[model samples]
Target: MSGVAGDDPRDPAGETKLTFPESWQVESSDGLSASVMFISGLIMVTRNRYLAWPSLLLSINSVINQHPLRTKEGGNSPISTVILGVSALLASYLPLVMIGPQKQVPLPVPEAQ
Candidate 1:
């Protein structure tokens, strides 16, 4: 009962489940982190007006730089390059969306005395 009862239904080998931390789920997490850091710096400098522009630029750069090198050297498929490019662009903007500017609530005015 001890050895057999605890066996996993799928593997029955008691192997540990494979996992990566949320912070490192994908290979592009590094790029996401960099985008977040840069966005933070931009927010510090100019608040928020110019935040999206730099993030957009960096995302484009990352996709352009990443796809060709991987495809040419690693012999990856064109579809893979397209997927990677789209993924990188999405990942870059995801962090920005998470840290987007807070919505302001207008205070209620007091009735005149």
Candidate 2:
């Protein structure tokens, strides 16, 4: 029997063959979103953070609700899930690393005659 990433074993070749395990997907998405939220929240806490929050929230929501945000679109593979999860987490961190640390500058002092 051919199995996809998150397909129901009972219906191996149904219309929803490539579906992910609801609970697993939810957990994975939540984990990914949480990681992303942390990274985003750390970066631009004021402006960009709010934008990033939705992706994180949606990711978590998708997981907890077991709702399929993205379709399989192909055959299933265990590695795919790992890749997806890791990619999501890593993608979030990339921006943080790119921004780097904020530079500090010492204030100039007036010279005494």
The TM-score leader among the candidates is: 2
lDDT of 2: 0.49
Q: Count backbone clashes in candidate 1.
A: 0
Candidate 1: the clashing residue pairs are none
Q: Per-residue CA lDDT of candidate 1, range 26-70, in tens?
A: 233335435445564555454454454555555555555554422
What is the TM-score of each predicted model, taking all chains together? 0.26, 0.28
Q: Cα-based RMSD of the predictions, in order?
A: 18.7, 14.9
Clashes of 2: 4
Instruction: Report lDDT per candidate.
Output: 0.51, 0.49
